[model samples]
Target: MTEEELRQRVAVAKKFMSALPFCHALDMRIDEAGISEAVMSMPYDPQIVGDPETGVVHGGAVSALMDTCCGFAVNLHPECVSPTATIDLRMDYMRSAKPGERIFAKAHVYKATSTVAFVRAIAYEDDPENPVATATGAFVFSKSRKAGKGKAADKSGAAA
Candidate 1:
């Protein structure tokens, strides 16, 4: 994709992030976005600490970040035009996030059909080799009938 097109897609992801109340509460930010992948960052906050003694980030927060990151990647997929809803998402918390460290989730959409998209993501604080969490999910295009430019059609050329 052209630089300008990528810029626009990133802008859209940012706008979408800003509109999510939960994301805003966690200070989620889009670090990068392209046609098939996205990276999102969230800074450590005392308000979200689940363990007072350890100051570890909550599992819920990490899961949300992964989910949002994966969704953003799916949103920018070349074949996925309309909004999508998560059909299934499974997140495994590999480790706890360190205190006062920013967490980032990088996600990529690996496959896309007319109606569904598959995505995977890893959440890490500093080293990508040791991830805090990993996620795999599938999102389906909105079943709404509203047609648009990038809408995928069925074999019969009808909107799916």
Candidate 2:
């Protein structure tokens, strides 16, 4: 895509996602942009507690951020559509992300086909050298056999 087009598309995606009910509440924001990569960040939220004693962010929330980050990375290709689902999502939690800490993640699209895409990313708490978790996922592109934007997939093996 042209530089201007890229800017416009990024702007559009940012506005679309930023306005999302869940995304807005979590402080999620698109952080970086490129042809095959994207970065996103979210601050700690009281609503995302998985364990009260540890003040850890819920694993589900982490997966949500990772999924969207990867999806945006794939969509950066300029030929992509919004209707996609995570075929598989594997998250490796090296360390629990603390509730007050910020999570910054960068996602890369390793490869893509008409039906499938491979992606990976690292998420850390303000420190790239010490990532809190890593993710690898397979996502499928879906289009209108009928009209719909498609649904986000479950982080587990369950279907979307």
- Badly placed stretches (over 4 Å) of model 2 are 142-160
Model 1 lDDT per residue over 41-117, tens place: 99999999998989998898998999899999988876556777789999998888989999999999998766788
Worst 10 residues of 2 by lDDT: 147-156
Worst 10 residues of 1 by lDDT: 143-152
Alpha-carbon runs more than 4 Å astray in model 1 = 142-154, 157-160
Q: What is the lDDT of candidate 2?
A: 0.80
Which lDDT values do the candidates have, in the order given?
0.85, 0.80
- Using all chains and alpha carbons, the TM-scores for the candidates as numbered come to 0.86, 0.81
Q: On residues 73-129, what C-alpha lDDT tens digit does candidate 2 reach at each position?
A: 877756566656788989999988967988888899888765687899999888878
For each of the candidates, give the backbone clash count. 0, 0
As for model 2, its CA RMSD to the true structure in angstroms is 8.3
